[model samples]
Target: MATDSPHPTRKALRRNVLALLAVLAALLATLVSVSSASAAPTPTIVLVHGAFADSTGWDGVATRLSSKGYPVQRFDNPLRGPAHDSALLEKKLAAIDGPIVLVGHSYGGMVITNVDDPDVVANVYIAAFAPAQGEFVQGLLNPIVYPGSRLLPPALQVKVVDDPTGVAGRNLDGYIARPYFREVFAQDVSVATAADMFAHQKSAALVANLEPSGPASWTRVPSWYLVSGQDRVIPPALQRFMASRVAPGHTSEVGASHVSMVSHPAAVTAVIEKAATA
Candidate 1:
């Protein structure tokens, strides 16, 4: 039997090479898996505050979301008007890469509804005004249509401001009078916190509420609504009315005020995270 065989060293070397190749293959597979997982996109959570409040209202929510490994952005709404704010938001959204979970509070809802961006995968309303096309925020805030709204005189104070755009009567800034800020906008938060929020409140121009919303993105995109059960600014009834228009079972209710994200950050974060995953 003339069986030819490699030298012992060569055979050992060949065995070592095979083992090294197997190790390399396993390592390469693991690296690919890690790369794919790290590359998986997690939608950015964009928070926009509505009338009588600023981006600070989203501090709690943003912190909670960040803790859970979700990217959060609190938009500095100009509070000019839906037409202007939405346009600005559209531009802002355009700059962001990957899917987005757009969450709006108060007038911010109006602005988000008007924005038409493919990146916005979900529209989450936190006691925000989700107006339909041709419908204005003011119209939805009507005390008659949805009573219990306290965002009226005594509670709301309007001041005429110089319009850089030179449009007469379009530059009015509406603030929730200091006395009623807590009750009207954030009743669930502490008095001190509410006062701080009031002091830093960003008023929306009257025209912002009056300007009719354009094509509502909610109609096309998936929407998640969180109704502030104790909200007096938009009225809980009105919130439900708007929520009803969204996809069924996408509505959540928290027994908080207009600023649920402030009063119940965990709940708000959960809703937004759900939307992000969805």
Candidate 2:
């Protein structure tokens, strides 16, 4: 007897998983916890992109969720800073009725946490920062900013610009310097891909980074966290600390860069779907 062997393709594997998920969803009503196995008709999944990125970065995750029959949408985060940006997010959330599973990547986590809308029943942090009360995005990046960070060459750098978004309402805007974007934020992506991501980055206002958060929404809403272990933008240690603060058994660690949601969409979507059903 001869055994047939062929290398499995990523697409083939994904299709298999999608099929399994569909079966599980069909049986969720009886075989599993309705809150955990469901892949549809639960809460809406909202994807929020962080700095040095646009909503397009969520394409992969959104596609996965869509394939699973889950309603998904990506919001264009105006990196106007936290308070103002969160307010804008609140407005967007207002347009989306019913329960929501808010998922944010990078700085977008700050915005979602700050929004804290009641409609948002759950939050998913995808290689994201979930700052505690009084914490700021810039403050978290200070180690990488001022130097002595563990990584050589320091993975990230920021620059201040005039309020280009117009929504910032502040004098200084913060942008991730393009020079290190590929190595820092999207290290898992290719040069050509990273270039496109860099080109589409939206700058956050400096005040947005300096502005401290109020009480965190995670404290009120159940949350899930996905930490990209190879992240250079926001140290992985910080990601773990934040994830620990969330509900236990709701955190996962994936080996990827800061932009893990793009590089590892399946992992990211699984977490979001978990939150949506939970």
Candidate 3:
């Protein structure tokens, strides 16, 4: 007979169910907070390789950056000309949603320098050319000014093959010495890696579309420059001059060759990490 009056008990049961759901909601919110805390930060790095090289040249650097929890993409630059490459790089930079660290190697430096992307938080030049206003890549090279320069390889002259589309070319070795290649391209690389690089070397077309850069990107964006002490290609002095032009406070020197990113990845990665955080 007493069980017939179930209103109070049923109300209590509804309260219990509501309390249980409230507890579950709190637990779910806590779980979400924990998941958010444990989730890795999204880091985007765009690597632009230099002359006579493809996107694969950044394989070593990409691995190091990825190991540090960065999402990295290496742009396979046409190596055609500065204007064309810069346009391509700008398009790539536009596609990235978050802030990005633009790392340029050798001539790729010029490409990053010209890309006018606001999302680009930092520009990292790894033993690469950092051109300033009214400068061309050709101007960066000394005019056979030093004996050491003479020892380095001569610049390759790229010409398009006879095709209706006027694309493709024959890559003739441009008087580059094996020792010079070994020193500049494979200084930190193993003998085998160096050999492989040489075998895969592509002919980079002279940037005929290159014009005097009007305004410098380093001026607006923070920059980090990695100087290769033994860089025979651009000359260490040139790197210093370029770094100074930007007035980058975060300047570093590694006792490696022009391709130090491949040889001394740890050092290069340190600079990139710094740039990303900065």
Candidate 4:
């Protein structure tokens, strides 16, 4: 054997070099796989504000999402009729590159229900309406939806503003009366903050709530719902019914108001994130 041992050290060195090269190749492949998985984009979360509220109500939720590296959109729902609002949302959605988790509060829920968006992974309702096809929000708020509901009557809590343009049903806006704003919408929020929010209230068209909604997006998309146990704008009973209808197992509740995003943003944000990751 020793007689055949020419350049044995060199042969041994070559073998070791080949083994090291194979190890590097395997490590490189593993790195590439992990890189691909990590590169996949996460979804965007869009929050649609309801009537008597604006996109600013979602400030806390938006900040939380942004800090966690999620792309957040606080949409200003026009408070127009369902079809018109849905059309605008659909067009805006066309520009987004990734998936979306659409969240709606109060009347905004009706708006989201009207849109047919394939990109929406899930619809998250936050003490919001979930009207079926041909069901108007105004009708749902009446005794027919949740008969024993004690939410403030719209006629008393809202100030009716006539359309200055003389359009009969177009711009008849309704603003939440400042005096009842605390009890009706933001009871859970601090008095100072509630007052500030009331000062900047945005009016919604009275006709918009009266208009009928189209087919519900929940018919196709998966959904998560958060019921504010003490919600005054949208009754707790109505919220529970909607939640059960949309997503039975995915529903949660907090002892908050209709503006839960402000009073209990953590709970609202958690539900939204659950949908996004799902």
Candidate 5:
């Protein structure tokens, strides 16, 4: 201003260059962030436990999946009837931020079969039920129809309990008799571990097995099945029948008991990861 100094003009040019550089840096950062986010966003894995078991049964599988960078959640299945249990699961699925790889074990399969969430990218059944609309889990337990099932009579126990929710009026809870727990549920696992599982077992409402399934998501969603060759609770033959209904070429067999996730966690985890990547 005193005499139109070139030095002042030079200082103004430097400031403009610095500001422009800052703007470009910000844009570059945003683009890189977007690209990185789109390139490798891992899907969340939700593991649902079946009757006579709780979420802890998924500990081994969940840990393996988590180590591979997939987020894992072991859903605490209500053990209530399918309609009520599915409603609760659907609500939880809605809150998740990204795609989900849903894995179900035993009766947990029936629960996932009823969920219609769009976020559920794939369904992986681990020696689990995959019922059709109007079909009930109890139907699959028929020894005449799906022979080799050992979850009946002397191997099982049913207790009449007062329903607090009044959904079942008088709830009938089904449990795998203590002595038969290992044989009927998890023969592949260690005897001590099976005993531990028996101690923490959660009974499923009898209505859960008898109640007819509503809309089945397996009809629409992509599915993968792991047939437990030695499964006593659901029977291998029944597993094959259900797996056949799924889109062909997505089924695998494991020589495991009904609690495959506990005894063969790696094999079960592999199926889940396959579904996730697909």
Candidate 6:
């Protein structure tokens, strides 16, 4: 009898509950749509490794970037010559759909500088070699530039001689033959990791190529330079000189070896993050 007396009231309460749930569902859908629209697009980081090395050199750095929700790609340049390498890098840059940040380590720095892509928002130099107009790698390196260099283990020196390309020869087996890669390439890396790098290395002909970088993109694009104070490969002085030429909006120095990206990823990433946002 009581139920019969409250039948209409019960129906009304059920209707209210259903209506409330429908409203909630609609609100949730709206929220999802808004979130989708507001989410920031992930930045693309194209890593170009310097001579006598391949894409694997960027492994740890790539992993760190990926963890932070950034999409990363590594280029395997033929390393035949500067013109050829620059063309390859430009091809990769053309494929990117949106904003991009180009990172060059060691000789990779030179490669990025030669890439004539206008879409590149920022260039990040990580203890990388940045040459000036009409300058080549050889032009920037001299015995005085590298002092107290211990990263070039004797084993690596031997390998360079054995390498048929002459640029790396057998030395490609030891580590990066370039003074910069030897001194700073693994500054932040462990002995084990550095040794491992030596175990699997590729000889690059481009190292010996004296061809000048025709035109540098750094002249037009905003840039950042991360100088490794303890770098032995390219020399701290050369880094300073090159940085001054680029006139990057931001410049920082880290107590790392030439390969700061491998040794101090956090520091390298911090600079990259700034470049990406800028």
- Best candidate according to lDDT: 5
- Candidate 6: regions farther than 4 A off: 1-40, 144-188, 206-209
RMSD for all candidates, in order, please. 4.8, 14.4, 7.4, 3.7, 7.4, 8.0
Relative to the true structure, candidate 1 reaches a TM of 0.85
How well is each residue in 156-251 modelled by candidate 2, as lDDT tens digits?
Answer: 345545554554533554555667777767789889989888888776665667889877899899999998888877788888878898657899
lDDT of each: 0.86, 0.79, 0.76, 0.84, 0.88, 0.74
How many clashes show up per model?
Answer: 1, 1, 0, 0, 0, 14
TM-score-wise, the better of 2 and 3 is 2
Pairs that clash in candidate 4: none
Q: Candidate 2: minimum summed lDDT over ten consecutive residues — where? A: 146-155
TM-score of each: 0.85, 0.78, 0.76, 0.84, 0.85, 0.73
How far residue 216's Cα lies from its native spot in candidate 3, in Å, is 1.6
lDDT of 4: 0.84
**Residues 157-182, model 4: lDDT tens digits:** 54446554327633557776766788
| lDDT of prediction 6 | 0.74
What tens digits encode model 3's per-residue C-alpha lDDT throughout 1-278? 35577799999999999999999999999999999866735659999988766777787788988987898998987666666778888898788888888999987888888888888889999988777777887766765542233223243333443322234533222323455567656667789888777776655654432455546789899999999988767778778888987645889999987788878888899999999886
Q: State residue 256's C-alpha deviation in candidate 5, in Å.
A: 0.7
After superposition, the stretches of candidate 4 with alpha carbons farther than 4 Å from their true spots are 1-33, 144-170
